[model samples]
Target: MAVPETNKVMRLLEGRHWELREGPFKRLGEGADQRLREIADNTSLTNYLRFRALIALSLYDNEETGVHLERHARSGIRPLPAEGFHP
Candidate 1:
């Protein structure tokens, strides 16, 4: 079973109240770029969350995010929430 924290995160990633997901990380600045990259690149994570990390990375000036975005864009991920999808 998924850990409680991870499970909650997965729930919030789905189409729901945006704040639960955004509020915590919205204030995060460039400092989070590296960690966000780690999350984006963590193959063990659900693709939905991985893509979410990429979305957050867009707020910063990290060039590496572009590469992740390109890879995800080509990954056939639809612009949908991270509920029952994986791409």
Candidate 2:
């Protein structure tokens, strides 16, 4: 599936207001390790913790900022403009 176009993903990676919960950073079956290594070799994510966190955020169920998003929407607050939509 196409990744959601939410800046919150990057924001979660950057350690901003939203925290990533129930991510997908566990064992990835057989050849998954090699795939991960290849990806790490090509990408900029240096630290394993950060990389795993990123994978968890992406490869798994993802974030839980519904309450936060609702608050922002209600109060007329917006994420960084780069995120596109306010929610």
Candidate 3:
């Protein structure tokens, strides 16, 4: 059977809440880029880091696509809630 993902991995996959406030694929820019660079130089860690980056990017990209679709589907609706507004 496949092993269940740990909370730490899930958290990384989900990313920080602050990133979500900005946009869907929030860390696709400088931060991930820099970390990947640092990891690339180390052969032992490069594979693990690259895998983590791929997982994070995939989750962020998938979420972003979903968000865009939701927005398009609701284009005629009233304005969305401001960032901090919950329900």
Candidate 4:
């Protein structure tokens, strides 16, 4: 998802305004972790899209995913979700 083509696609498809979560493609399972990481790390993508990738990663309950969200918050990408919101 960090690739230029994917970045361009994101640019073309990002929402005009914030909307509630409609969710990303699911059923990808753990194999998608690395791609999601790339998506979350791609600064070219809007925070909204990157944030969706991060939220997908958050489902794994992995420490690194947590770190990504924290870093994003500190970097002003977006605020970290409140605790227990998804539990």
lDDT of 2 by residue, 1-87 (tens): 233323333333444343445342233333333333333233354344334333443443323323323434475533333333222
Per-model CA lDDT versus the true structure: 0.57, 0.36, 0.37, 0.53
**Candidate 4 lDDT for residue 36:** 68
Query: Would you list the clashing residue pairs of candidate 3?
Result: none
Off by over 4 Å in 4: 1-26, 76-87
lDDT of 3 by residue, 1-87 (tens): 332233323344343342323342343433442333233233453244433433344343345434544543476743323212231
The per-prediction CA RMSD against the true structure, in angstroms, equals 7.1, 14.2, 15.0, 7.7
Order by lDDT, highest first: 1, 4, 3, 2
Residue 7, model 3: Cα distance from true site in angstroms: 16
Q: Which predicted model would earn the best lDDT? A: 1
Clashing pairs in 1: none
Predicted structure with the largest TM-score when compared to the true one: 1
Give the runs in model 2 whose Cα sits over 4 Å from its true position.
16-19, 23-42, 46-49, 52-87
Q: Which scores higher on TM-score, 2 or 4?
A: 4
Q: What would the TM-scores of all predictions be?
A: 0.48, 0.25, 0.24, 0.47
Better lDDT candidate (1, 4): 1
Instruction: Say what the RMSD of model 3 is.
Output: 15.0
